[model samples]
Target: MTGLVAAQGRPVGTMGRMASTAPLPLTVGFDLDMTLIDSRSGIAATYRALSAGTGVPIDDALVVTRIGPPLETELAHWFPAEEVPAAADRYRALYPSHAIAPSTALAGARESVAAVRALGGRAIVVTAKHEPSAELHLAHLGIEPDTVIGRLWAEAKGEALREHAAQVYVGDHVGDVRGARAAGAVSVAVTTGPCDAQELREAGADVVLADLTGFPAWLRAFEAARAA
Candidate 1:
């Protein structure tokens, strides 16, 4: 759970279909990469560019498969520990040109966030991605969140979620499940990232959906249950 906090007292992450909530807005936290945006094509392209620039071989295909962790964590697999910082910097530098253009929203991403906003809830993105890169992807696709917090993963994501008063956290990774639970938020896992439904369930996800397409209905049910 490597944490990259945003100064002091910053909020982050959440999800669903639709049902008007209480007068107060509910804050929901989301994982950026596979959860909201499918940046694999762009990420792999960036890695290829980085490998070309550094003359170090990186398995771009394999890299995209594990997209939840920090950039440095992936770089560690290829670069020497001492070289990771420099490599990570280079990757971020290459991301805008190589990654952003090809990046796209996962299924129901826009609707899921919109559903939250429709209910007067705040939709926030908490990701291990570089903040600037995350913003670029969102801007490119026009899938907006109220707030975006970057460089946070696993349980470290809880810090942002807790600060934001998020009651629900949605993502496509087990790390995301851990993050939601760490904040004492309901973990809604989507099988759109690296993890499968069984894997997410085993990780203690409160609910599992095939993709964000199911989120709206699930959210409606969730709101009904809560209101009940």
Candidate 2:
């Protein structure tokens, strides 16, 4: 889409630089798991519990390390293809208890959300997590995004981004870069998740940061430059 290249020939990999004439984004989308919350412990715990109950040997480390993909995808990795559906059901059934309390907001999560709101922009979370679970995390963190979309990943997430007219999409996975590109939104990748900066960039991230901590400041600078 035209919006994917809307930055007017600016270098996509550079942070804190936007064209002065570029339009300021009014809607921003965020990924939930690594981008906003540190959920590895909870996710690992749930998988361990599932393994115990089913007598299936699940590698807790592997599960935790692969958090960005949907739970079904993870389940398929651990279970036989034919058994994946039932295993996914059991995982979801046990997820809430193991996940909720252990989850915590990542550094700058609140401030990043605030930065978007401070710009009179709407903040929305688009994630591959189940809707209820994603909502639970947001409620527990006391972060009220304008909307939360769940169970959509990669290009599927682009549909929601387009629906919201999101101008910027921030995430911590390669899938997020694909989603942002699909939606024609600016892709902001953070290295807080399993993927490294180079991996995210290779997946087509327009901008990359060390973590969410740098986002608010970069966003402010972008807006300031736009206004100048």
Candidate 3:
């Protein structure tokens, strides 16, 4: 039920190299999973469970690499399309209990969200994971985003940005770079996922961060530019 679905839309722009000018009021979009919460331990456990259940002998590194997209998209790469539904069902059934028990929020994530909110901006979470699962993870992290979109691909997330009127997107995957560009929003990439800063830059991200641990300074810079 999730992938990059093309809808008639405007393309978003990246906050890439902007002219020295005033910044505009903006809504910020964020990615869940690795960007906000460190799901590595849980995701690794999930892969282990999947391997044990299917006897497919999955590799944790390979599986973890697929964490940024929809479960069905990842499943399609390793299994038949017909098996995707059941695999997703099984994964969902197992994850809450067996897989994600060790999940935790990333450092400075909560502070970043609050900082954005304090600045009269809104933060919405856009994720490729299932919606409910995304929400649970957010709750687990003690965050209350203005909105949470799940199971979306780049183009789908672009559409979501249009719906939310978002002006910038902060994420940690190359696909997020594509989505922000496609949506005509400023794209900011974080190096919290499998993708590296160089990878995100190559994907045409507007901004690249080591992590959200230092977002307040960046946000302040953006605000200053906006007020200029």
- Please list the C-alpha lDDT of all candidates, in the order they appear: 0.89, 0.90, 0.82
Which regions of candidate 2 are displaced past 4 Å? 1-25, 225-228
Q: Model 1 reaches what TM-score against the true structure?
A: 0.88
Q: Which pairs of residues collide in candidate 3?
A: 11-183, 11-184, 12-182, 12-183, 12-184, 12-185, 13-184, 13-185, 23-225, 23-226
Q: Give the Cα error of residue 121 in candidate 1, in Å.
A: 0.8
CA lDDT of 193 in candidate 3? Answer: 91
Report the lDDT tens digits of candidate 1 across residue range 145-196: 9999999989999999999999899999999999999999999999989999
Query: 1-228, model 2: which lDDT tens digit per residue?
Result: 332333555445332354444665688999999999999998998989999999999999878887898888888877999999899888888988998899999999999999999998899999999989999989999888999999999999999999999988999999999999999998999999999999999999999999899999988876677566
Best by lDDT: 2
Ranking by lDDT: 2, 1, 3
Error of 2 at 72 (Å): 1.1
Clashes of each: 6, 0, 10
| Each prediction's TM-score versus the true structure | 0.88, 0.87, 0.84
